[model samples]
Target chain A: MHEYSLVEALIGRVEAEARRRQALAVHGLSIRVGELAGVDPELLRTAYETFRAGTVCERAELRLTTRAAAWVCPSCDAPIERGAPLRCPACEVPARLVEGSDALILDAIDLEVP
Target chain B: MCTTCGCGDTELVPVELHEKILAGNDRTARHNREHFLEAGVLAVNLMGSPGAGKTAVLEATARAAASKGWRLGAVSADLATDHDAVRLERAGIPSRAITTGQACHLDAELVHRALHDLPWRQTDVFFIENVGNLVCPAIYDLGQAANVVVLSVTEGEDKPLKYPVMFKAAELVLISKADLVPHLDVDVAAIEDALARVMPRPERIVVSARTGEGLDRWVAWLERRRLELGLVGRIAGLAGHVHPPGARGDRPAG
Candidate 1:
């Protein structure tokens, strides 16, 4: 159910672009969901099917790429790997989360030009 | 050279969107920020779990700030009901109860509409109290000048560690309901320690509305941070349009 809401956001964006281009249909969509984005890819795919029915994105193939969270410590300036409870492994300080945690751009949509 | 053209292996061309999906939402958030600026309003986003005394805190803020001649307005978000808004208005500030209607988080678009219709010009400060959620609300920016993470002293110290993102992202950490601290086993030191693990040790204020403790410091903090809210709104209006993909055609013929 949580994933459904994110899926709705993704679908809504694609539909907006689709309308703008006067696209016949969305053939496929590519998205990169960050590991720390707090979204489940499988659940997103499932929810996508439900919301896409009778929509412009109907029959669109959803391609997802999961990115791991990356952090850089402020004091020591070392990269840290993703962990459940995030912290700097080197300095043990709270790592300044640099990137790979954002719920970012739903990459691109493959459209059938009208 | 295009791969299909096969002109040469030395030349490479890449087609990428390089655009954020949340960009649209961010743009709307920027708009909301500008609206707050022109109106000279301070929007503080209050986030925490359900029953974390978010509404209670707003009530206290309204009452405390009112004496200082700071006109306050609050927008309380929930899945349903304006109960929190109703109670907040009784504090003598005009409050709006927002029913998200199946939406888990309050997005920027919704806040934009709320601001447009809100009495932004009349209020000196505006508080957008998010739905009682620690996780989802962290992702959706409500265009607040500062994000305040409210934790009841009764919720235990490890709360900051458990919900690290919310605590870490907050500009301020408020330990609410200090009245219950005497009876509870809440280790204030441990909470402070946990907070240091996730974020730079932020200004921590402990307050109990009933006891009237730490209210002055809280009000002072609001006064200090008031200008930042106006800046938030102004920046949003300045960034009015986004350049489309490949729209920046100007080049020096490199």
Candidate 2:
């Protein structure tokens, strides 16, 4: 539901960055959304489709990648496996998230520069 | 359609910019956090499902807050109306409400704007009742010092597991409406156990607004956090800004 807002913001941010870089138009957009970022990839795609019209990103191909923040041992820095115990088998301590957050990062932009 | 050379007089340059898409939101949230800190207020974000008894929990806590001589104010965000704010007002907490037209979650910007309408400076504790949706609200930071989720007993015990993001974001979970637990087949212990699945050691307490059960512990939790504010005024350091490795610093807001 908030995908529209996020996409709207994404397009605006991307367009502004493109203009700042003196690009004629954006040709490709790349973004990474963490699974815990609460953005559904399919829904985000739909939002991007709806919101990209007439913007600098119009006709621009969007490359969206999604991932999860890993849980790692706080003491040993060992990565915890999926479906594994919350504790680190090596460290024998509870595991913690590598990044407790999942903020989406705009990776790169392919722009049509003048 | 390009000519034989396929030249459109435009060079396709790849700009390697690794920046957060929600950087804008994060900057605003950091600003909001600074504002709250400056006002000497401990802001709490209360989120849950629409009928999860968020407002009711606040209502239940109002009397305790009053007796403790705590200045309380609330900013309520709902999709359609300011009814939640009114409910808080009736319960003796001064409140301002924002009706999010289409946004499913109350972003930091909305909370920032609403601060002007609220008595933020005079309040000891400022509660922002996020729009009643578990999924979207968990992702956005409203610059609150604490994030508390209310899960009523009427809801499924597996909610914490289903909505791990929301449950994980919460510093504390309230098993709201504990009085109704006897009538339903829901198990409070199971809910707590499910919370532990997502949050290694989930900090939770069961409560009911109707019978005043477990509210004392709830108030104590708030009191403990409020007291800690003196020692940790810079909630800015708590979790607002965690830059990724080699990531660029904040972009100047336009």
Candidate 3:
């Protein structure tokens, strides 16, 4: 999986935050992956499992959620359903993804602070 | 019952981060963009398949840019060889080679380091010729104002349909090796239609480095896009674009 590098980046970001906050240990973490981010959750989870050991996230549980790409027609305000093609079923123009999708985000970190 | 089994955790505080996993890379890429602007350079992230003729296109581009007086710099990446850099330099473009080793794509760190190796003062347009893979390269932002994908006729027309994410990431698609169109049974229109289905519908220009087809169009696109991206104005003001206050994720150091 291309996930190995992504896992490396993910772990580093968490480690940086853990160090900055003076956390004793990381207990848990939650992340949001967009559908268009090209990351499979299971693959990411497995990748994370391999890389997390021995890091600040060694004992931390990962919670992953997917953010659906909210596709809207160029002219329409309403969103098309999930899995819709890149077209407005109604307007037939082009579809655009609203903000907040296509990103892999760390939602929260459960850390043990001194 | 809240365990799910962290099971009666003693003292774990929930810290809200909402940070993007790519935020670190994004931050560095933003810095690279500002640095490019400092030298009046416009950057392009060029990505494509392994044999999609990216080096050939750059060679052709160098030849085309000469008459127009466009100064081009390249940071070329491959898994093992510096052959592309050699080829580009032979073509008269100032080029640096980055051997990515096991990495399938070029990240901001490599680009940042490679930037120093380029002749910044001589470069008005810089190209980060990404490790030639259609997938991983699209996900990376190398501080480029334009993302161009090169797809050759040999690769087939339906590649964009099969690889949506990479195609979707492109701002421009170069249909390379157009000289082979008459011999091959591929339908260029089908390729264009597939791209239209991709979100943001990237603009495409068909070109052949061998026959010099559409190279002028490609060069003109670069010239037009450089202006569109406001390189001149950014370079005019000594202290133009600063890193956005929140562009960096919230670490105390940030």
Candidate 4:
């Protein structure tokens, strides 16, 4: 899956940032995954464990936060429930998805510096 | 104790990055979009399951576009062979193939590299036939003006509902192999109903690549899309655009 590739990118980013701060080691990593992002959190965790053996994140705690999918009605500005029809309940128009999908943000990282 | 500086205690700091995991790929996709726009080419990303006749549709579209004096180019992706690219070239279009050894989907970086290998300047309509995968391809954007998903009559009508992510991301859906409808138990209406349930007002075209059944309508839709993307002078002298066949009714291939 593409999770491995994303993990590798995460490693690279974390390493670059750690080096910039003259950090000795990494302690933890916080990541946010959206429901509609098409990424499985379990798979991502497995990838992180497998690929973090020799990287700066070798001993870092991986904290993953998954967000739910939400849709906002374009016509009536109402929040539609997840798994509901894409149409707005108020105005009966197609709602726009404001958030809860397509997010893969690396929220924060803990680094051990001298 | 700090191992690096012989300090009494280690100082831990929290860094806020707040960056996307696929930021690199998205940046490259954005650049590719600018490049395509600058070249005045209409790039269409064609995606679907394997054996869904993605290549066949490309071939038919290539031939039809050629007769109208329009230039078309394609970049096909597969895990192992260059067969699809060869087939497109045989159809008289400038084509190239990207062989992604272990990867299941085509990313923007690979397509960017493939763009350099083709004569994109002379191309009016460019097509990227992604690796025949319905799942992974929907997650990656190849900087195309449109994402078209192909589904054949042989596949069950519940495909759209089963693979909602792919169907939802697609701008257009092509129900290929319409010629085999009468010989099979597939229900076209059921497929349309499924698509409607998953997607909001999805645009669809039913075609049979074997007999050139809906080539005119398909080409007319493509022409309109290209013109909308500001490819005015490039497609000006091409064959007059045919009006898109009206209504959602399916026509049995003759």
Clashes of each: 4, 0, 0, 0
Where does model 2 exceed 4 Å of error? A78-92, A99-103, B1-9, B231-254
The 10-residue segment of model 1 chain B with minimum total lDDT is B231-240
lDDT of 1 by residue, B1-254 (tens): 23577664332112246566667777888877765654456778888888888888778877777677776787889999999989988988788888999877788988877765666556767888898887778877777788988888888888877776677678888888899988988878887777766664456888887776787888888888874433322332322233324432421221
Error of 3 at A78 (Å): 4.5
TM-score of model 2's chain A = 0.83
lDDT of 1 by residue, A1-114 (tens): 466767777778888877876666778888887755656678878888888888777888888888766667788887764433346666766666766665565767887662
Question: lDDT tens string, model 2, B68-182?
Answer: 7777899998989889999999999999989998888999999988877766777778899999998999888878899999999888988887888898788999999899977
Candidate 3's C-alpha runs over 4 A off are A78-94, B1-10, B232-254
What is the C-alpha local distance difference test score of each model?
0.73, 0.82, 0.82, 0.84
List runs of model 4 lying over 4 Å from the truth.
A78-85, A89-92, B1-8, B234-254
* Residue B7 of model 2, lDDT score: 69
Candidate of highest lDDT = 4
What does candidate 4's lDDT look like per residue over B113-197, in tens digits?
9987888657778899999987788888789989999999999988988787788888889999999999999999989888865
Considering every candidate listed, which one attains the maximal DockQ?
4
Those runs of model 1 whose alpha carbons end farther than 4 Å from true positions after fitting are A19-23, A74-76, A80-95, B1-15, B227-254
Selected candidate, larger DockQ, 2 vs 4 = 4
Candidate 1 local Cα displacement, residue A25, angstroms: 3.6
TM-score of each: 0.80, 0.88, 0.87, 0.88
Q: Write the per-residue lDDT of candidate 2 for residues A16-68, one digit (tens) a residue.
A: 88879888788898888886787888999999998889899997999987777
lDDT of 3 by residue, A35-110 (tens): 7786777889999999888898899999998877676876976676654457777777667887767878888999
